[model samples]
Target chain A: MTCPEELDPVRLLTPRAREVLAAARVVLERDGWDTLTMRSLADELGIAAPSLYKHFASKDALRTQLIALALKEFGEGVRPVSGVAALVRAYRDVAAAHPQLYRLATSGSLDRDALPPGLEDWSGSPFLEATGDPHRAQALWAAAHGMVILELDGRFPTGSAPEATWDELVTHFG
Target chain B: MTCPEELDPVRLLTPRAREVLAAARVVLERDGWDTLTMRSLADELGIAAPSLYKHFASKDALRTQLIALALKEFGEGVRPVSGVAALVRAYRDVAAAHPQLYRLATSGSLDRDALPPGLEDWSGSPFLEATGDPHRAQALWAAAHGMVILELDGRFPTGSAPEATWDELVTHFG
Candidate 1:
């Protein structure tokens, strides 16, 4: 079997692909991840199950693209910030606004090796550069994610102001 | 309606209640979260649907206990460690072994208010105590969680060693 760099499936996306994805979002937001099956998505699109296969390979492939879409949206959602505190808050805001999407986006494997054209820059790159060290950026990113995940999971203590805690994390890292 | 402190549902768990939870785990592990319903769990336990109501009030309640059980198991999974590096490894190991269970446990609302009786001591409590500040504890916790989560989600750069990165986080915080 030949490596089909020329035959990349995503490059062949049609208008119908976008339609399938939009229907997926509706199902995801309404019924959630578990119920968002290929059959369910096909039903939403008013298409046969086999028709979805022509656009997307499988449910897993569709889910991966959905996560990528969410990540791209998250990158666009936050205004780029030079300061650590502002960046942290922006990250938190995105997670807070779309917790389910955030979870889905966070749980999936990102295609880092070969992202599509114009899709390589991660949402955290600017904030990461501002930290001056890639490793420090990773730590800061983890810290913010930890706080938000804990908060979303209701594992943080009552009266724990995550915003204030975020500010403190920024200082702690610096 | 009076809030009966004596009528706490979890506190009132019996041996049979433990059986119900054990059966729920079987269903959860086998069928995934969507299929781990009251009816499904009942089928696993060889009981009628309404009988589960005696031990657990709702599916949400069952889910909470399942998470608590996961946390308790996680606490027991790791050997006690006072150093940050060891603690981080332990947390990662648990997640790696049971990714789905970890996701469920992390997503649910943990009882941070009082913690179930003996749960004040988490696997990382000693490491947190080593930091000597609750806020620092939170930061370190977040850092470890963030790294593990990113690693799990395949967000880390290809060929990146998360173990080394974890060590760097320990040094960064310390």
Candidate 2:
């Protein structure tokens, strides 16, 4: 099987593929993972359903690509921050900025085994290094994931002290 | 609205209600909250779809009842234990025994705003009292909820060694 070199770091996508991805992100942000059907995406992009098939084989393929894009965006958002405290702050900032996308990324929307060919390896290194221990890294991921969910669900107190829980979480990491 | 008289607290349900709840739990366990249609639950119980409507007004009504059942079962599971350490142990035991049910309870499966008529006072009181401070109660709930999700997702360590992370959380309450 030939690896999709179109996804390589040095390779650039054609303009139409870029447009498809941009439209997919809008669908993801607006309707979330459950409603992001290929037909819906085609409708959003003002293109025929068959056109999406040219860019992505199926809904699962489209999801894999969307997840890859979300992870890359997440990495970019958090890259400048250093240390656990800063990392936690960065994570919270990124999550708050893209609440729906973050929820979709963490909500088991994409099957781990079906990740875009090389994308899993590319994504793991930064997260693995952040927590030092693999077990702690996984726990931290859950904690952060839960935090985003709680925030979105309005479980956090709404008042003057908006960032209190987030500040406490950062302190725990430190 | 007339309150249903309290039954045998130990049993927590009429025999028929228990049968309905049991079928509901099976559906929830096999399929997560999103797919728990009223028709599906009736089909699972070998009853007509309309019969489920006799028991539960809607899917939300069924979910609210299921959560109430889960909370009562959870309260009973942890009642025999005392203090923070024992409470933490009981938390893990209940989570392990009924992983899906536990998820349904802690995750926002039940609409907090539209909780069943008398359930507002019944939910989480036992666990909260075990923690004493209201602030710490919220944190303890978050930690326990986060821990159980991680455990159910197979992120927790496999051995029987007590989790230091959990111990630290309990320490905050003690």
Candidate 3:
């Protein structure tokens, strides 16, 4: 089996790409986007920074790839559920499960203009489709993003359950 | 009409406090929270940093004072609106009007637990009252915060009419 670093670019091989993405996730989780430099990633893999250009062209390229990976993971996590309520729960669960990646993905740090080809179109499609209204979809994304950031910051009501708050949001929209 | 630096501690008037707050706002807007040091503020005002200590004991004290001023401005901006639709519009306007202050106020840069007496309690009251549900209120704040941040970041849909998005959100909740 070819390692992720040596895999062919054109074909889909889940395990290899998954390994690279997992390493990227570790970089995002431990050091955050600010410190997730190419050098750092290369160091993590015991390779030189320039060698990373083989997998990803630039820092932004690496970030965009990681964001794409995150969105794919996000889509997968929310795939088992359907409808508004289940969708809301799945969205919240994905955010909670990968708080760091969620923050980095939604932090407005990635340039929409520079979003990798085909990735931007699919990033928020799940949530948007679930809401059934573009405006509501935008608002729901903002609300969920806000909830996760506030939750991570420890700004939400102390002792107030996350699931309960999520239920109220769903009810309000419903 | 004494300058802020000349105001006596016990006898300082509202206008004097406003002047100091304005200086603080300038610091926040230009340098952001990280570089908003007393010396930098004093340099902006052409006064000694020690003089600032008379008005605000520390950076935390100055930040809390600024948060109070920001909340006051925010409250005043949204006070006249009635019903949920009006409230959402008013909230959006406040955010758009002072994007920097809005970011600072909601950035979790301040110490919530050490908030000055009566400051935090009164600051978010208007928002809480508008939503009428503690959970909803919390969600609303998060949503509003995220909306402004994303809007400023230019992540929201730009082409066509986006105000319709707000209208849809309001309709959904109502």
- Where model 1 places Cα greater than 4 Å from the true spot, the runs are A1-12, A26-31, A35-57, A77-79, A108-124, A159-161, B1-62, B76-80, B83-86, B93-100, B108-128, B159-161
Candidates, ranked, lDDT: 1, 3, 2
Order the numbered candidates by DockQ, best leading.
3, 1, 2
**Per-candidate local distance difference test:** 0.68, 0.63, 0.67
Off by over 4 Å in 3: A1-24, A34-62, A159-162, B1-21, B30-68, B159-161
Worst 10 residues of 3 chain B by lDDT: B1-10
For candidate 3, the share of real interface contacts preserved is 0.66
User: Which candidate model has the greater TM-score, 2 or 3?
Assistant: 2
Tens-digit lDDT string for candidate 2 (B15-62):
776788889899988887767777788899888888876666677777
Residue lDDT tens for model 1, B62-170: 8878776776666666546566667677777877787667666776456553336545345446545667766677777767677776775566664343554566677
| Residue A54 lDDT (model 3) | 66
Best by DockQ: 3
lDDT of candidate 2 over A70-89, digit per residue (tens): 66667667765557677766
Clash pairs (backbone) in predicted model 1:
none
Q: Which stretches of candidate 2 lie over 4 Å from their true place?
A: A1-18, A48-51, A116-131, A156-162, B1-18, B34-37, B80-84, B117-122, B125-132, B154-174
Q: After best superposition, candidate 1 residue A73: deviation in angstroms?
A: 2.5
Better-scoring candidate (DockQ), 1 or 2: 1
Better TM-score candidate (1, 2): 2
